[model samples]
Target chain A: MGRLRPGHLVEAGFWLGLCLFLYVYSFEFDKNIEIYKFGASGWPRAIILLMAIAAIGQLIHHYVKGDETSSQIISAAVDDGSEEAAHAAHHETVKWYLSTFALLAIPFIYMRVPEWIAGTSEPGDAGLHTARLIVAAILIAVVVYFIRHHRVRVMLMLPLFFAALLEDFGFYALAPFFIIGVMYLFGERRPRPMVLIMALIFGFMLTMFVKILYVGLPVGNIEPFYSIGSWVVTVLQ
Target chain B: MDAFNNFLQGSITLFSDPINILIFLGGVIGGMLFGAIPGVSMLTLAAILLPFTAHLSAEQGIMLFSVMYCTGVYGGAITAILFNIPGAPENAPTAFDGYPMTKNGQAGKAVGAAVMCSALGGVVSTIIMMAATAPIADWAISAFGPPEIFALVFFGLAVAASVGAKTFWKGWLSILIGLMIAVVGLDPVGGIERYDFDMPYLLAGIHFIPTILGFFAVSEIFVQAEKKVRGSYKAPKLSVDFPSLSELFAHKFAVIRSIVIGFFCGILPGIGATLAAFMGYNEAVRWSKTPEEFGKGKLEGVISSETANNAATGAAMIPLLALGLPGGALTAMMVGVFQMHDMQPGPLVFLTSADLVWVVFAAMFYANCSILLIGFLETKTIINLLRIPFQFLAPLILLLATVGAYAVRGLTIDIVVMFLAGVVGFFLRRSGYSIAGIVLGLILGKIGEQTFAQAMQMLHFEWSGFFDRPIALGLLIAGFLTLCGSIYGAFFKKAKTPQTPDPDSA
Candidate 1:
């Protein structure tokens, strides 16, 4: 919360360690199949090697040249706000990270649940297989944990869970409407008109990619829900 | 003699096309708009407009793209002088003196000098490009065997390494990182993955669209995230007056010198106008009787830098249009545009499409004239763009960065890439490393890789192949001399600062 420290050696070490791990893992490539001359792992290996070397060079610079000036710059960055003010400001920031993490966990949790009350037992394709879907969900959650701020995390989940659910309930186009409602209105505080403008923009994008571009989307068990999209696609064809 | 006569015929053919003039004017104006705007990039314009050129003949498309390249560079000076913020990365030097000058109530004069100087610079570069390109292309087409290419790649990498702070190890290390990132995709020759990590995207390695947006646009957002961007710059109330005769004559030597230096720098693949501007600015500062006036609002500093940067634009096209070696991003875009219209860019390009080459040369000259006109007429309007409040601007900037990042791959994956790159950039800055060199190296990494690999293969993996290529050998010598120049730059820059207690200790 005070500020991030500029410890070149620490960063250099971490990246170097990651590079080594990636290289070591690359050794497990199945050579039984002749995909290409160098195999799948060659490019990754080269990247890892170069990254490791770069990290070492960074460490060397730290050791020999010693850039204390940059360290002071980092310290000065946070000092503008007194330490107390910074401490107080940090909590709200952390909340966004927490929310984003929780939002990401939803699909994974649903996957681990053994049985659905009523729905298709099997997903449509290989990518949508129940096991793969769960893995994908978990991957997203983990990635989101590292990536997004926590405050909007829960709001992000509102899309797939609620909107996608409503689409199955026969409100096909309307299901996406709820999504805009939740993310734009509920997530951020703006006057209703501004929120409406944002919602319309989102709607336009939905219409473009889904209806105009004819992108395939899963609408759950809801029949007659995507009639508008289907009609548009039919017309274009 | 035959090629020369054919070239003359081609020039006549180019001049005969009325549509070519319109294309030239449109490209220059559009390029100026793109370069002045924060989110709009030269590559973006080139890529988007390429499809439209599919209907035209190859020569017309090449001419249009060249205009875009030339004018996009000229436009950066507009925002740089008016706004404290630099619209394009290359305009950083312009912001230093130009912004300070604007605050000194010479906004009109600064814009005038920048526009005029840039025009002069570009015109000089265009002439040089036209004169030098044909012979150079002939030489390159014959000489660039694999060994020469290998040597050239090494030279480019070394020049990239020369740019980062004094530590050679750090610079090399950065190049190593860039090369590693470049190595992730499938091998072109061997047809195998090196570091695919089993991800489908990894198979393509990293595309320029996503990577450029990530590193340039997104990282910029994160770095400036905590700070306010928009500064209070009232448009100065005045007329567009040309520099007085004596004032023009006083800076004649610097202007001519910068154009020459910038042209040479531009002829080299990968260095581009950014370095040309910096070189010009440095020399101007060093020679200035009022070196102290530079960052405080000296018109000479602005004139030298703006002139050289725009000049480098036309010069960069010479290597690309004639020799099939693009010296910068804008010219690289030109190569794509040319290919789209079925105009192959190479040594044979001039021979097969002489009219197209002449059209591009003609376009470069006209684009300078067009920018000059726009600069003269719309001087106040352009300066007033600086008056917009930073708070309102910053959020819009973030949105644009996000939208642009998303547009790159049409993948959410790129959005994630943008965020990651920003954080990485932030941390790199925190670590006292020069991101400038690393970013530049990343951009050039693939060029070096493909060139090196091809060159090596042609040599049958012989080490001496690099030395055997005459042009490659010459470039190596040039690269070595540049290192010496950088050292001298550092030494002199330090020596001039008398206020520092211990210059030696520093």
Candidate 2:
């Protein structure tokens, strides 16, 4: 038996805590009916109990055998041995935490700020549109700065941002920029092929999903973009 | 005879529509393209297209998936042989002998064997699937009650959890997490919410489509993006030569053995094509006269692996159709498709949607045959798709995933759920947990819970009543034994000494 790592203990403890919380929460469910002895909470409670047991068993097993097997497997799956070593060298750096926080927070800000601004103003107010544009510009500048330095983090944050803005900005108004932005982030420098690819993808989505399938893809809620989205759909139909 | 008649009638109806023929051919081509790419799995394409299935007829939708499943299993062999990259996990075994052959300048012969054996295995398995599915469903309809069904689900989850993880405990924990996810909405029996926390979206239950997309597609993009940052991909030179009839005839017995292994393995709930491929290769090596030649460019190795994986594609559908138990993630997504069409899989589905079921059978059979022609003609063209960088495709895939998630219920919340699931899946994969086990648990948990409640009610809430039913008792015992075996292997087995890390290995 070897010594367990702190990371292993934390992972095991997370599962144990989660299972315990859910098990306690299951008590809030309605009581058992006449025909059913255990009712709605029974199945979840049973599952949670098993999960807690597994978590405890895992903690003990790691304590006895160490996490070498798991570490090797994870390292192998993620990268070459040298790359894993490199990752380990900087695993505890503040840069990693900051990058992850930025990746998560950018999308939250992108999705929430507009709603916050809209909540304070009337729907058709000109000031609301201007505020949104200013916020969007600042966010885009921040993303561009990160893209120059932390390409992988920006790659991850791009999808989250896309999801956050997709419904409000609409598919047509937002998709081409997304395609170009992603291609550019990926180091596709040539503008011609990027434009061609963007057009092809945009056209395909419009034809297959909107024209043929009649999927109610969102048009933007705001002016100009909203009219543009509807106009394209109307033309396509 | 009735099954054969149903199959014939299905062929007639399917061929009657030019549009169906077009969709079938398109699915085959699309499946191969997706599967041949290193980063893209057929599951990504399937998840992206799931929303569109709602607009098509049930036959078209199911047939599209059926053919894709058939061709996708074979398409991965192209990359495995030529580039040393297994397009999907199931194709990983092929690269052992396949890449060695490529290095030896015998890539043509390796590919030829893979194509022939894959088609043969798939066709044979489809025939078996068609013959066996109706009878199995009939037997299940006759024999299985709520208790038996619950026990079977339990067995399935246990076996699912036992395979495909760094340890049995991690696998089991993943399954428990998935079951917890499934328990979020209103309870099936009493309609009492378990974990909804008073949100209307949560009350309807988390839709599985977004979860599937997030776990399989978005997480895959994240994985690939990290790889892209670490390394560069190069295109492989393509060469293919079909084997002579005489050459193929020499390996007929190996092919037969693999087909048998693959089909049977595919039928087992939660065991899928990846296991079948490895098992086939293992059995081939065991039976070979010069077993030492297997990993060193033996054609039998390629034949066994490709054959078994493709064979499992059809057989994997049997459990999904007969008992509504999906053997893997792709089939689990198929369950979502079935629900999207307002149909439930299982015995009653055969009674209600016989035509659709038969069409799927015919489509799979035809899809396998089409692979023979298409694999021969378009091997080079398909390999060309690898030239497109993963960076370019990642955003497009994310876009599709976003739309696919939202289009399911026209809910923005589903998109959020999908992204969250993707992040969770990425971390889960990093930690060496089985995403497939989690998925299987999510799909089966509701059914298991419903049946458990009904079974308890029928038995007057006596826990011991399950033991009175022989089939239920047998299944429960099997599940218990599987767990015990996993525990024993985890603890009682001697641990291997840690070795120095190999710097060159990727």
Fraction of native contacts (fnat) of each candidate: 0.09, 0.35
Chain A TM-score of candidate 2 vs. true chain A: 0.78
lDDT (Cα, 0-100) at B415 in candidate 2: 86
lDDT of 2 by residue, A124-221 (tens): 66766666666777887888777765655676677777677665577789899888887777677888989898988888888877888777777866
User: Who wins the lDDT comparison?
Assistant: 2
Q: What are the clashing pairs of model 2?
A: none
lDDT per prediction?
0.57, 0.79
lDDT of 1 by residue, A67-137 (tens): 32211111211111112222343422445445544654554345444234223445343333444345445
- For model 2, residues B417-477, the per-residue Cα lDDT tens digits are 8987887886677666777778888988888888888898889888899879999999999
Off-target runs (Cα >4 Å) in candidate 1 are A1-6, A25-51, A68-237, B1-26, B38-65, B164-174, B221-224, B228-242, B332-345, B352-356, B385-447, B474-506
Winner by TM-score: 2
